[model samples]
Target chain A: MRPPLIQLQGLTRTYGRGDAAVSALRGIDLTLFSGDFLAVMGASGSGKSTLMNILGCLDTPSGGHYGFESIAVETLNQTQRALLRRHRLGFVFQGFNLLARTSARENVELPLLYRGLPAARRRQAALAALDLVGLSDRAGHTPAELSGGQQQRVAIARAIVTDPAVLLADEPTGNLDTARSHAIMELLTRLNRERGLTIIMVTHEEEMAAYAGRTLHLRDGLIDRDSAEPDATSCC
Target chain B: MLLNALLLALREIRRNLLRSLLTVLGIVIGVAAVITLVTLGNGATLMVKQQISALGSNLVVMRPGQRLGPGHDEAGAPAFRREDADAIAAEIRGVASVAPVVSSTVTLVAGAANWSSSVTGTTNAYFAAGNWTLAQGRLFSDDEEQAGKAVCVIGQTVRAKLFAGEAPLGNTLRVRAFGCEVIGVLAAKGQGAMGMDQDDTVLMPLATAQRRLTNSRAVGTVMISLKDGVSASTAIADITALMRERRRLTTAQENNFSLMDTRQIAETLSGTIGTMTTLLGAVAAVSLLVGGIGIMNIMLVSVTERTREIGIRLAIGATGREVLTQFLTEAVALSACGGLAGIGLALLACLGLAAALNMPFLFNPGINGLAFGVSAGIGVIFGYMPARRAAALDPIEALRRE
Candidate 1:
């Protein structure tokens, strides 16, 4: 009976103008309730990344309405959108963009730093987040010193440190091997199932998409198919 | 937010320690040059003023020249006579003493030591006019001066050269054509304002020197000392009028003598030196500006190099202003560190220079503080462009950059 956490109606995104204009997103209509684990699958240039960018509040749609918990996302200015991203949305990139020279602990503390939390509290929360991602013993290691799987774990720790409303992962295992990729996917599924965290992931792997409760397939910036399980509420 | 930005900036600086040091070197040299020049210049000005004052406070020299600067036509000017000196001493109310001098370079012999020295012919009032003190023995008596007695006062240089550590009070030293008894030893006055050796001269009565050495009644210069609480300008005006009247010069004719105030000369010289210092300081400030440009250049390169990092921060919810503050803070810290190092280097250099030049090491806190403030300002001014550039970068585009 609860309202959807995110609702997108006729969403559209275009780059440039006139003859040079490239329409990245034609129109997308989607809805997802709280605690939902959704996977967005598309080939390169299929606009899945564009859609995820909009969902993360990192980019705005050229046309359409996006509402997060009844707040109009399109009406917010740059600072308001930044605040939305800071307090509500978290992102994990494919490249695992951890600060190169910084330790994993400090990397995780970054979000709390932006929140203006005190140093001591930020440290405790960052350590707890690292523990959650199973990277507690590797807190002192930098990105260069850690393996790809461990680095991705640190990135995931950074994302969840602020306890945001949703975690947005874009090809979170793109750079890892099959074994590490399965491990990371299992970690994400565990976090979703155990903690009931809302996660929207962009991945092309069918196996990765299978782990989510629902799957949305995009073809040429339009939703080709939506596979929502009949008993999604029962799983939650 | 500020504390976080500062810590980030410090960490980034430490990350690129070599580049940061190179960027700061420009500022260091600029600030050090400015401070050293200013401090040394101040000390030199003080030294010159002191030497000029040592000539005598409230003293004036009248020379027989119609022009002020060098290469003047002194041939047509009438020299002062003994009566002219006496008349000015009697007529001028503020006059303390007047000594009319005639000087000649002569070789003097004492035992096996023969040295070239200046022989000055003057009255007993020469000591008062010159503010000279006697280290030992008394000045020639009034009776001796009136009688043109062959008695002389020897300065410290002449004493050291001719006396050679032995007592010279009753010793006889040969002048140009006659022998004279050394009645007194003048205390040392070191070097004069014009770098002349003040203690390499001998003094005797004007009449005595005129008869024995030159046989000329014309005095080359007249030294006048003013009494305490008397203004030099007023005394000069009175003496000028008295000299004109005594010389029988009409209103249509120009006076043949030039009056020089030691205080005015000191002020003009010091003013010139002060202007030169400012000029040097300005030139040195240019280096600071260059240093600032270096910072901006390095910062721009850094912003470009860290595009991905900036994108990460932006995606993590850092505002453009926050990014600006971080980069600006880094630039300012770089320049401020350079400023501090420059100040230290300047102090060390100034101490060494002061010792080498035999001048006092003068600390000017105002200049030091100004240099520091300006160098920091350089950071803000030059760093803005790069910081703004970094802040303006699109997060998506930046993130895509390798």
Candidate 2:
């Protein structure tokens, strides 16, 4: 019913040149709509990280057509891509990359700070984002003072503080215990259902992928399977 | 964005305060050295010029030697007599006054106080020629000087040592075989051109000194002062010609005398001081440059250590330019703080040293401001490369670093 928010065609990423070249992604063709919750799974060398990096605009594909909301992403320059990320994309790293020794509130305010928002509004929005992640009470606590799960929550708050169109997460619960991993997944699920936020996650855990509306498995840099059947033309 | 960068820089500095302090120590020392040396050097130069001028800019001294420097062979030269002084006073057109002088070191006893001091013999005209002003009492009278009366004018230091707060005027001072009455006390002149105390001697008439101290009629020096609007070179030529003719020196014979211009001495001494100041300033500036290199080295290390943080910022949409600005701001901030600290330290050091060395405390705003500006400029010059490195880092690769 809705147009696709992201479209990728013939995406290929290769590291190095000539004899030492290693192809991280052979080719990938996919279309994702707004509010879609997708999980990507693969083995260690299956290029899941490379694909996520390309999707996050942190790396450019060797050859590809990447369209974000009908705009060609591959044609954008580095500064343009950074601007795209600043205004429309959000990211959560596997390491929960919160600045060490910084409070959760300031961490959340970072995006707004980059956006050049006024201090008063940055503070209000950061507080609101922290509250959404259920971390309002620990907003003043630094990463070292917080638990792993709480740190992940703060990272999520930082990611969503700018209200970006898509949230790309790389193994968001990789370092958490079982109960904490489940708790983070439940929080993601709640954010998806209540706020209708679009999320693309990379994980190897089956249970974590089970929470997403769709799952794609990769083997040897190619899609092994797609859990949901497409209603449009399919390549595989 | 700049505000954010500044805050980040300040926070980073505060995080490792000790390391930050150590990193800027080179800059602090460099700036402090420059300011202190220049300030003291300037003070010394001013003191020298003042002391030289105090000897009277228009005055010249005639000594019986080929030159005024070391190893001068004045042994064969004839000493000047008081008649030569009288001849110059009468024959020289521009001569305002002339006083024949002879000096000898003698120990004098006044009450319980005893001091070893140089006793100078000259006419009352010596007061005007040497720019000596009376702080109390009166100068030698015509009758006193002509009769070679035993009346002396004590210098301030001599009064302090020999009189000890007691009224020196009309008091008798023992000088060799004769007892001279103190008729006046000269005003204090702190230090002379050669760092010697000027106010540590006694003055008497030419005849009195020759009779009581030297036991000879030889005048060791002839001080001549020129009238206002008179050319020193012209007057010197006239005086040299007259002296040479009186001594019956032919054109083939070298004049067996030297002339000392107070203004010339001032110029030579000031030039020497200026050269020394420049040399020391250059050395200090090298330290400043080395300090800049130190900043660059530390900044490079900082960029390496904060690679992950840079990656995080980049991933969250920070542009390369923003990252560059952040690192540059940190460097500039660190160096600027060092500059301020150096200025404060130099102020204290200059004050203490000026007092200890008995030099004036001369505060030079231009040098202080220039030092600060240069130190900050060093930040920009040395910070650029490391900042560019930080900005050029690939987000993916940087994040991959452990």
Candidate 3:
């Protein structure tokens, strides 16, 4: 049996101090194995976003024990965490935070550049990433010229270009319309099913959550439910 | 990595061409002003020294006593006489040549055209002592000097003015009412030490000047030339002591004479010009400092603009040091472009002025290297803070920014 890719125990993420101290995540225990497409759902400020950040290594939990593929996360220094993030995780954001005034291909190449790849190799990897996103034809088109859906796809390509162990997305389809959101979710589902990649996503919409293999519901930082959606198979 | 940063920097500056040009204008004007003024000052000092050296020796002139006006003052010392001139020449130990001179302006009537010129009285030794060379014919004879004969020689400009494009040697030109024969035409002297027209003069026997022109036995002043390998200080002291003994100068009064040294004048003028050049170079350097400030200001704006970009880069595996190096490289590239433009402008200005002013073009390697080196240094110094800020940005916060 393979080790769990993500293990969170006694995760209590707090904010502020004194009487104003608020726990974003309170005493949550969770395990996510490889190839698991889990959706985290909550209302606005219900700690879904905070949970996503901690899972993606974007933010450190105030109090928690997080083990990723048997590596202790809470004990790691900043540089070590950053290195772990670079080598093991990927992130897609709601805003599609691609570099402006730069082309789709170049934006994808940015991650590889930080990887310290050679110039020619950087360009080749960027091209392959664009191809995977099916935006190879629009490789040279800047973010300003690309559509909202196309831009998000480019962002997705950048996130996965480093070939991280798991992909974590936050409100990845929040900016899209119904059809585009379905298309993006369908792309996410295909990557999980075919690549067998572990994925965790945060969203408030039940419709988007149904696409994942499992759903974890949160209310006031505590896990309220952890179950497979009845309609999850149909969406997949 | 440097190339990428530099390319971005170049693109940014290119996008803001008008502002970049305006910024460089300050440097251009400042550098041009410095180079022109400094070169002119150097040239002026050299010109003065050349004119002074052409005078041949440490020469001193006595124009009667200390003059209240421009002309001779005969109050303190009696008017210079040929007898006193002979007495000084024979008695002064360090004096090589003690020739008396009297000058007057008169119109010389040649064939048809008439030219107004000055006739100076001096002996044959005047040419050797004054460093005058003959262009044609011969110099005045010793018999002409002693017998007070009416003979004269003409300078180049006087030759041209009187002869009017004709060979003037052995020709008679009317000096006032007396006709004097031009024995020789002196070499072209261009302008004099005081920027006056030295060539526009005639040299005549000093005796002839007193006997024919003024009909007086007195001269306007005495010209004394010291011998080679002689020190003016010691000679001046000996002459002062002897002249005092001869004229009975009482201990109560000041030496009623002014001593003029060409070397002292040259040194004073050179020192003043050097000071001016230093000041001009300093002013130019101040503009470069302002240019550095402009670089800093723009870099701050760039860091703010690229904050989100910095965050994204950090998230993508870029270290803080990488981000810092990127911004620093951009700043350096910007300044390197400006520095190159400035140097080109300075060279153009230097060449233009060289041709316009007829000065020899001199390209100083030291200043050029200094300008480029200082420009790069300005980039590094001014570019640090913004680079550090970019490096220190929190990737999470920056990426989350709307």
Write model 1 residue lDDT over B257-332, tens digit each, in one string. Answer: 8887789879877888899999999999999999999999999999999999999888989888888999999999
* Ranking of candidates on TM-score, top first: 1, 2, 3
* Candidate 1, A1-236: lDDT as tens digits: 89999999999999999999999999999998889999999888889999999998889999999999889999988778888888888889999999998999999999899999999999999999999989899999999999999999999999888988899999999999999999999999988888878999999999889889999888888887788744434645
Q: How far out, in Å, is residue A56 in model 1?
A: 2.3
Listed in order, each prediction's TM-score against the native is 0.93, 0.87, 0.77
TM-score of chain A of each: 0.95, 0.96, 0.94
In terms of docking quality, how is candidate 3 classified?
acceptable
Candidate 2: where is the Cα deviation over 4 Å?
A1-3, A228-236, B61-95, B106-115, B135-138, B141-151, B159-184, B207-221, B226-264, B281-290
Give Cα distance to truth, residue A166, candidate 1, Å: 2.1
Pick the winner on DockQ between candidates 1 and 2. 1
Give TM-scores of the second chain, every candidate.
0.93, 0.84, 0.76
Task: DockQ each candidate and list the results.
Answer: 0.68, 0.65, 0.37
Ten-residue segment with the worst summed lDDT in candidate 1 chain A? A227-236
Summarize candidate 2's per-residue lDDT along B1-402 as a digit string, tens digits.
788788888888899799889988888988999999999999988889889888887998899979774466688899999999999999999888998999999998888888999999999889999999999999999898888999999999999999987999999999876889999999997778888889999999998999878989999999999998888888889999999999999999998998867887777787888889879988998888998899999999999998998999899999999989999999998888888898999999999999999998899999999999988999888999999999999999999888
Please, what are the lDDT tens digits per residue for candidate 2 over residues A1-236?
A: 77799998989999999999999999998899888999999999999999999999999989979989978998998888888889999999889989898999999998898999989999999999999989899989999999999999999999999999999999999999989999999999998889989999999999999999999888888888887764323745
The segments of candidate 1 whose C-alpha lies over 4 angstroms from its true place after superposition are A229-236, B66-76, B211-215, B244-256
Q: What interface RMSD does every candidate have? A: 0.8, 0.8, 2.0
